[model samples]
Target: MSKLWLNSDKNESVFIKLFQIINNKYPNYASQWLNSLKDFGKDWEDEISNNISKVFGPEYNDRWEEAATGYAEFCTEALRAQVFFEKHGYYKASSYSDIVKECYHDADYMKVRYLPGQYLSHYIWPHHQKMLRHFVRELIPKIICEVSIFYEVGVGCGMYSQRSLQMMPKAYGVGYDISDYALEFTFNVIKKHNLQERYEIKNQDIISSPIEKKADFIISQEVLEHLEDPQNFINGLYNATRPGGWGYITAAINAGHTDHIFLYRNPEEVRTQIEKAGWSIYDEQIESNYMEKPIELRPTIVGYLARR
Candidate 1:
């Protein structure tokens, strides 16, 4: 619904009239600023994007119709607001905080699960659980133990550590990230899950986060590429793994992700480095990063079971 295309003619006409009213009412206002906002056209209103296709039938290209309908709504609001502002002068408001205010927002880590793709946290969480079960069985198979301690890098929305804690009893997890927004989102998820006792959220660049002690099992999933220098972090993680201990790592290989400033691109890079740091690669799997690209190109992501 938020992705709808809009009606050009109608939006243009509406904009023209709105501009006229603004110009008439506020002759000295910033036209350039207003012009820059012109790109919003009419789609600023996301309400109609979903229904436009169904209501307009096949001829009305739902994209354009939804866009047009949404713009119609926004244009009206803009007109009213602009006129009111021109008459009433200015209202005082502070700028948004540097960090995102996602605490009140929704996620599975917290009590609510409104975050799309979160309730269905099928990506890394499942694999983390699988690896934990495998590692724990090897560690203390007799007791129905949980992977109670976990550290997740690039903890986007905090699902990785959250799921780990859910699967393990008396568990404690930490989600570390640099972005204030990412941390805020992670914290919100943590709060929602009422996991304050077992889980800790921190805003730290994974590459720089100080590790004094080795973890029972380190869980790093799909987080290597974004660092300025991932090699040091990789080596440090290896050094942090205790002998007979496990660290399950995952990375995308030969993929072009924009946020990915660095690319693990090869599972060998991870495997080789971990081995040098005294960890042996127990098992490695090549999964379709895209499931469509040629096998080599789709080298997409690789999961390595590294034991020190």
Candidate 2:
């Protein structure tokens, strides 16, 4: 029962191909798989990009078809899993029932994503490089002289971090994330820009990071929507910042987008959460798609400035 790749009316071969590579040789179910792709189309294009980011992602410019094919492979894997489980009466089902738990193995859903996704934000929005400059110039106060530390959590590929460093010229940062692959990607980007002499970053779960450094400021842009645990992340933010230190968190609110677990219908909810976690809003701003500035939320961006 090999998986078969399904194509939409538009010849877009959804994620079924990727699943096929991992599951069986080919994929099965034409209509069902096509429907899933249709369902996924309900999401905005940006959401679609984020959902399969590990595939086509950001860096690769002209490879969306390839990513879609990869996604098909992933879907086939799901089908194979379901068929295998049904045939062998594989322990019925459980809370964590996405993997093959036949005899003695815990190899579940870490199958793909070993290479980490390309930078979706910076890639989709080339002006994000300029936007980073805007943030640095707007936030970095004319303060005491020294190589200041600008911390960026969830620093995907260090693009923003590098841009910020370029704007300030004497500042470095600790780009933090939960994935070593992401950290490595950022490291490579930083090295390409030759900023390693100043920056010190690591692949760490911000929610559980033990190392504490009181940053002068922190920036987390376009990352909150993906967080499944916003509260703990807020607490982690509190712990990461020094007294009177500040943060810039930009997110997509209320928009039914991709990987959006903690929905923010409005900016106040995020502000409220941060306040509840013992932080205060130094300032906050909202940008709808109508604005000309890059920071303007085109259907999903919400930006906040808070103090800890």
Candidate 3:
């Protein structure tokens, strides 16, 4: 493995150690992926590494291995979905129940691989990395008033809520998700961050039972595409947010995964849906996978910062 990405002598750091693990596991692909991130500079890599080390402590290496494994599995599933989409012009699965059975309810897969892989992707994948930076640097700083409470819908690995609480030191958070494994993973993450007192996890589906207690801020990242009715979900987000409250919602457009059900063709469709749900868009970010395919077939992600 190359040390070109490291800024200091902390070669045994979680970030450097994970890079070595990835190189050992998938040398060719890892080389290309690491090279793609070279332009981001060592400071970017150090921040991510330090964050992971702080969050996971001694178990960072173990978690990083799981993330690398999960990333490989995720990529394989994505490639298969891409092939299916190319031939069919749509995502493979439509029913939410099927995904629940195959993905959310699968304890072994969700806990050991899928969720960890997803957690890792937030720092590794360029698009996800950009989204995280946008949320931390651009979105959170926009809230001028002191945040008392916030909600994260479908808090996969709980990184967003954890990061939010870190920034808003006095704020409390509630995370809602249907998957027990996801909730468990999030609970561990919160505990890791020593935020057990400030964060609460609930095994509830917001789409079925919208949260009655409105929050000062709400976040639903990459969750819109998983539901059968994203519009209803967005409405639920709107209702859960107090008037003049802020929201950060995001979705995958033309992106295929085993669990992704709803297919968004473009960013406009997503922007229109959020606007219909009564969120006044303050700012937005759209990133494509940069595949050579046409716009409709390319994988894309769209995020919004809105005021309800």
Q: Best candidate, lDDT-wise?
A: 3
Model 1 clash count equals 14
Per-model tally of clashing residue pairs: 14, 22, 0
- What TM-score does candidate 3 get on C-alpha atoms? 0.92
**Candidate 3 residue pairs in clash (backbone atoms < 3 Å):** none
Error of 2 at 147 (Å): 6.6
Candidates by lDDT, descending order:
3, 2, 1
lDDT of 3 by residue, 98-191 (tens): 8999999999889776787777778777778788888898778878364799999999988898889888888999999999999899988888
Error of 1 at 190 (Å): 3.0
Q: Would you estimate the TM-scores of all the predictions?
A: 0.53, 0.56, 0.92
State each model's CA lDDT, in order.
0.48, 0.53, 0.83
* TM-score rank order: 3, 2, 1
lDDT tens digits by residue: candidate 1, 1-308: 01121222443333333333334443343242143234333442121222222222223343333333333333343345334433443211111121123322223312222122221222212332334334434422422253456677667656556556655657577776655555665666566566768877677654456666666667776666545556677777766556566676777555442233454545688677666767777777655423554544443556777776
* Candidate 1 error regions (>4 Å): 1-148, 206-209
lDDT by residue (1-308, candidate 2, tens digit) is 31223332332333433333323422342343333344335342333334344334344333454433434444444345434433543323332112113210222222222122223333222233234434655655432243378788877556667666666677768888665555666776677666788787776767665547778677787766556667777777777778877777777653332233455666677777778888787656554432442322223455667777
Q: List all candidate RMSDs to the true structure.
A: 17.0, 11.7, 2.3
